[model samples]
Target chain A: MEKIYTRPSYIREGATSGFCPGCMHSTVHKLVGEVLDELGIVNKTVTVWGVGCCILGAGYTTHDSFGSPHGRACAVASAYKRTNPDEIVYTYQGDGDLASIGIAETIYAANRGENFTVIFINNSTYGMTGGQMAPTTLVGQKATTAPFGRDPKQHGYPVHVCELLATLKAPYYLERVTCLDAPNVLKAKKAIKKAFQNQIDGKGFSLVEIMSNCPTNWGMAPLETLEFMKENTLKEFPLGVYRDKDAE
Target chain B: MEKRFMKGAEAIAEAAVRAGCRFFAGYPITPQNEIPEYFARRMPEVGGVFLQGESEVASINMVNGAAFGGTRSMTSSSSCGISLKAEGVSQAATDHLPIVVCSVMRGGPGVGPITGSQQDYWQATKAHGNGGYKLLVFTPESVQEAVDMTYHAWDYAEKYRNPVMILIDGVIGVMMEPIELPDMVSDEFIAQNKAAKKAAYAPGPREDGRKEKHPINVSDGGPMGRNHADWMKYEGWKENETDVEFYQTDDAELIIAAYGISARIAKSAIGILRSEGYKVGLIRPKRVYPFPTKAFADLCPKKIKGILDVEMSMPPQLAEDVDAATKGAIPMEYCLTSYGVIMNRDDIVAKAKEMLNK
Candidate 1:
């Protein structure tokens, strides 16, 4: 009998990922692994992980990966890619890491057109910090920090990272995708692959913002958060290709 | 072998490039702005990377990234800017990255002045950042010394897999002086340096040609385990890395202890006083992190009456180390200035005479 399916060789065998049940991190990690393997650049790829649930990738993946201080993954990736132009480098950052504390790093790196990929995980809340309201936290959404719901009058509006980066001229690609179901997960993988491919093609900065879910942080069942995502989160952060220089 | 006239900050940049530093990311600030300026022009000629980060924090993090890629990387700033880089410095310490940081210090509790000051002595050698991490701090007293120290800093950094700091004040940073610049490192040396121990941690194909299967995680041994290991590494530096100079200290009844630009002022005082039959000398600490406590221990108590701590800070920072070294056995005096005030040679001479008379 022919083998039907196999895990990407980049992921460690029998290694248990420490992500919470129904967390989208594992799904995104799988997509990255598949993309890296498909490109045959797994050996030359360097993944800089932001401080959050994203850091867990360092444990699950077998490639050369390391953790940067919270919100500085983009800066780190920029240096690595510039110094080692022949190698592939990317940053794995959460919304809190990429959109809040690290917004400047992310923006500047994209502005400089650093040839690197950025996998941004927008989970609305600070998943690693017990569901605190993040920069991407939806207005009127309930978070631990926003117990009564995010009030725009007090707290700021949710940051649309893809739309914000779309205004930058240097970015080569910018797309927002979700991993809500099997079909959506495949689409998310395609977008992530293209982000990496743009770097491989010597294109400028590319970012794929994955609309993720945190069941544990959201205080809901894994399945319940998926429904909530479509009804609420998607309304604030619609999925689409915000920018694609290649298409133009 | 050719001597070149250059500013202290430019000499430092040239020395770093000669020492095989191929990546530089820095933010522009007073006194040290020449460093990034020089790199912007020179790095392109050498086929190296130069970046002016949006902030000091981002610049240092970029250096961290380049260092992790197994390149000789650096970042520089002045006192207040160095404060912003504290976070990246601590992260580099935790990761055991071989990166060089230069501080052409200006005055500061917070942006006090743009002129020269030795206010960052404690920040450089003692509590540079969180976790009580220490850098192998080199305090160069002159422009020539600054170039020399910056050139060799990368070797020490890689040898210990730790950050090395070149701590000079704004006085030296702006002053022009003649110095012999080292020859540029060859391409082979750069390749060998990167492939030496970097292959183990950097991404790419392994020498054995086997694909990596394990993640490059820093917390594998737990925080306590890592911290204890780092503590041992720091302790080893005391014996192997301590560097100092004893200038006519053998038979002196009084010695002036200083570092960097303040040491240059103290030396002038020592010269004049020694010629006039005053039994005064100087103890210059080249590397301050190890504190050169042994240099103090080696001083003969019978001949040394007291030590004068000279610095361009409001209160002396090196005095804490001097006290720790002598354990209150030696009486100490301070001739101090602050807020970018250059230390006066006459004031140090007066302070030393007053201490000797007592």
Candidate 2:
């Protein structure tokens, strides 16, 4: 019988990912690898790994990979692309890495129009750190640090990264998508591909903010977490293209 | 090359280009601003990249990334800015990435002053980062030496796959002096250097054409193994790379231990004391991290009266190293200042006389 599915060639075979069960990080990593393999740029691509649950993603791909300290992936990726302009460069950052500690680097890289792609996984809570409150944590959401649910007065509000980055003039594309279900996962793949294509086309600065689930951190089963993200997380971080200069 | 009167900061930037540096990312800080300014105009001309990074933190990380990409990369900042870059520097050390960091130090302890200061000696020689990883620190006493040291810094960095720091002060950074610069490195040379180290760089196609599968994370090999390997690298550095320059140290009665601008001032005091029939010597450490402990051990404690540790910082940071090197067999005295004050040769002379009278 002919095989109906196979792992992307760009993904390392038999290497185990360290992402927690019920986490969306591995799915995103697989999608990114598939996209890179499809584009035939795996050898020429360099991925900057951010400090988060996805940090292990560096070892999962066949591309050259380097890790930056928490929240500095964009800054590091900018240097990689600037110095090696002919190569493709991208950063894989989590919400805490991009929206919090690395906000300055993320914003400035976008403003400078650095020709690169950013795959931002917004899973609300800091997954690797045991579900602590993150910048993208929704109001009334429960976290390890927010035992009584996140309060708008005390913990402030969830950051809409797509909206925030969309305000920048230099970014060629900015989109927010989710992977709660099969259909949404397909949409997220398309968004991620577009972001990578923007960089390939020499368009400056493209980011796809992926609304992801953290079932282990969210204290729910995998299926329950998907439902919760579809019902609640999607309302706060609605999935759509926030900005596309090409559409203009 | 022709001897040209160049400012210390400009000389360092030019030397880096001549050393085949093709990527520079730095933020403007007092005393070292001229470095980034010079590179801004010069890098493009040499087909290299010069970026004024968003902050010292970002700039250092950028240098780390460029270094990982197989390019000769660097960053510059003063003391306070260097403090901000400690995390990135530590990361680079952990990954064994080769990058040059130019710390043209101003007074610190928290932006204490913007003028020249040797307050960062302790920071550079020790505690540059957590994990106890040592930097091969070069303290240049003059613009010419600064240029020469900056040129060779990349080679040492790549040789060990470790970070190398060129430690200067605001005085040398802004001061102008005549210097013969190194020959310009050809683009071909830069390309060859990058190709030579391609295996160690990221996105690697290994020698057998297999893709690299392991992430360059320091946390690999568990905590114990990681720490052991990290220190092994430092041990290798101390064994093979320790360097110092001696001036009349063999027959001298008193030896002056100093570095950077303070060493220059100490040299002047040595000359003045020698003219007056005093036998004073200078032990200037070109590479401070290895700390030249062997050189200090080689000194005859029977002939030497004392070690005079001179610096431009109060509570004399260099004295700590001097005391350790001499193992308390020979007494050490300090002629020190802080708050961005330049070390005066006359004060050093006075201190030398006082130590002799004792």
Candidate 3:
């Protein structure tokens, strides 16, 4: 008789997500939808989805969405925000899509101080293509491409996206949070909401990188994936606010 | 408007702005760099946006995003840069977004040269991307036609909800010519068009109780149904969008086929041949994709002795289209110069004379 839980209006009703079990992309999607709803920008929001795992993101939300080519989401979002400055624009991308092929686009958009938010989901390995070594793969992490454990000499070191972006003067905010546990997920939600708020205030280039988990790709159970992220991945990519001009 | 001298690259950029294009995203490349340079100065004055993208791949994707937001958007690059944009252009076509791409052609086969060349004819007409989708390829022969084609390209793009390309060569891109620009589009008109497009196609529910549809999103039905629907739109384009320019094809012993800068040279050659008592004609395709198949088919093989395809590529590219259109009934010859060399009028005239003698 009483309604305990109702689907968010921005989320597609009776639709199941295509993410793998224990994948953090679905959770991030829900957080984005919730933030859009709370800020009352659902109608005027346009989200660009990168080519990897987030290509189908438009189907999950009710807002206007565009699917960008591989590693080009930030560039697309930059133009979208500039053309329609009053509307809210954001991009959902993974480490492989952002740090590997799209590194130049990512850096330039931040350098130009384009007014948009980027929701970056960084798992150690490439989840969509069956656990290949990503740009953010840990030093000793085992992946399909790095079967002998990632050797820094051969594969290079992991990219610290937040710290790298912090060196630039323009970005209004840059934070790295995780969704491994309930407390961390709450912190991540807060960081996301603040990023969106910065855009509403006309601050330029806000990015919140979420350290996510890929249980299926990591060859671990859902709970074990959380432990692996905290014990190993967090050491390389520490969770903290790497840059926040507003705080200064 | 008074006729003013302007470069072809600058004219196209001015024409796009006059056509209510509110967004321009492009990268710097030889022969077409003036296009982005012009936009960088003009966009802010008109309350529009101009962004020099990091690469051509990013530029096309940026244009796609801007178009999705209900703004008339465009991007420009040279041949090598256009190759980088092919993937994004294909995605824009599949997503049914309206964006204009101006490719100022240069030498190809791996950044061969920066000078003018028509080697990109096949790349523009036959295979723009991996997808089987075809773009409305407009070949402009002069600075005036470049302005005219670009001014109207946005309308055609929005009408069909497809990508349109203005294919020109470096000769036309860098050459200065006197042209009258089109009437300026007012801010109110741009706002009205953007609002109308958003109402018709923007995702989610509109005030008119119409729901926005995503034809490319496979979650609706599947990619097969969506692809079939997109192909139907392409079929409609074939019926109404084909355009060509005919010059003295009525009583001709030989016909010359060309487009873009090559067509300009062919016209000059035709003048010489006409004075020399040769009954030679020319067929220039204005729209290369819905290619002038009907124009080629209408040529009477009985009266027409042979067709000479003039281009700036080693092995002729447009000749292949002519071969298909004529069904191998008419004999075809080639007059070409590869490695970014512009076709000379004298060379085309000599080639036409030789073909006629044979």
Candidate 4:
């Protein structure tokens, strides 16, 4: 059977209108859509917008959208899956949304073996909130809030999502991909699709952490955002698949 | 009906399970652990869900989630646990989530003794959440009503979409008795109940073979946000406004305000007073929140020289309401509060003498 672009996803018309041009949410949504479409699990899926930028992301998607509190998407989805045994659940979160606010949710959902997928978009800054320092911000990186560069003392350290989540047993798929380059973009798409497929097979929690560029929030032009990803972000938060239970 | 034997706490738990409860979450606390213990095995046997939560906070929130998930969810606590639960309970009531909370009365203000005490009346009837809301608060005197109302509490919760509490004093939850479990909603029949429930509140996934996500919900509980106006529509359901009962208020010159075991004890005291030619009667509102004010219209105040309220809460909460609810009627008098047995007839007789002197 042939795969379809427009399936039963709730990500429908004009949701792209809600975001500013060059916003990464659309790219992330596209990756999510591409996966759900190819896997043929779009209908059996429920999506949670893990606070922040995707608060209204539920309105854009064609899948079932549940807007989770800043960090409670995974916890809510945990109970959601337990109640609806046959359904697939996915949580879309940004670094600030998942890593900082929802650290408990992020770690525990993976640790509990909850049958779901989480697409973590790491732009290294709080995009919707005007480029604040995220838990995933490259150490010593400068942003609007951390204008003088993030200090290891007062500002703490940047977290690595895939590395941190990799330690948990709940996840069947764990990967870090990026949209900074064409090939990385393609890999991130494949990773997103794989994560969703893993969930459809009842493989438990899976996460695809995408290191993407936030040109506007990074106070850089679109091109600089990509350059910055390579020069600064990549050096600090490297991109790669960190774990795969099936491969083991 | 007459002359039945039941342990106060067991009857409350059994009555709830008998009354179509399908979900329960709890954390064990002394005196009330029997509720979770009683339902844990029994619930699974009847195809229900039960989880001993990480803490009282989790237990209450989990029940809140399960209630919104469309099942009869309940939680139990003693004094300290109930305090930790104030936020969740208030949220549940404001959201009008039909949840049943059983508070097995224990000494309070901070991990006091685990022994029996009826000190939570203020928490139950007063508006304590983020909004001006009340509960479908029921006080059960006997084990039979404890069981019967435990089931009835679920129905009332659904009917009003509010938190319904069975405020059982320690004496009630701790005392043992032979409780008759009502005919239950059969396992197959539960499917029908669930279907009906899901119809009213299910958040569907999507039509295209994808699960539809129903946004996590608060039926009406929260800050004045998305559904504030929609929640206001439940105004007619404000417990105090649309519900009630009557004592011998028809020809009585004076009435006593009381509820729960205090009322049962008051009835005995009132009977003794009446025989001695005192025109006094016990006015117990079984539904404490829906206080039967209508029955005492003129008698509310400016009636006679004597009206009394009874309770077992420390220092006396029942007496305070008798004064407030009556607008200082006949200069309301209190029989005092001592948790052990609701009343010492001799002590109540002394208080009655004080009220009559006025």
Task: Tell me, by TM-score, which candidate is best.
Answer: 1
Off by over 4 Å in 3: A1-7, B204-215, B218-221
Q: List-wise, what DockQ does each model earn?
A: 0.59, 0.60, 0.54, 0.28
Q: Order the candidates by DockQ, highest first — what do you get?
A: 2, 1, 3, 4
Best by DockQ: 2
Report residue B127 deviation for candidate 2 (angstroms): 1.1
**Models sorted by TM-score, best on top:** 1, 2, 3, 4
| Candidate 3 local Cα displacement, residue A245, angstroms | 0.7
RMSD of each: 1.6, 1.9, 2.1, 4.8
lDDT of 1 at A163: 90
lDDT of 2 by residue, A1-248 (tens): 99777898767788878777877888888888878878877777777888888787766666567788989999998988887788888899999999999999999999999999999999999988899999999899988899999999999999998899888888889999877778988898998888888889998999999899988888898989888887899999888998999999
lDDT of 3 by residue, B16-102 (tens): 999999899998899899999999999999998998888899899889878877899999998889999998899888877789999
Better of 1 and 3 by DockQ: 1
Tell how far residue B325 is off in model 3, in angstroms: 1.5
The i-RMS of every model, in angstroms, reads: 2.9, 2.5, 2.8, 4.0
User: Candidate 1: which stretches are off by over 4 Å?
Assistant: B205-223
Query: How many clashes does each candidate structure show, in the order listed?
Result: 0, 1, 0, 32
Q: Let me know the TM-score candidate 1 reaches against the reference structure.
A: 0.97
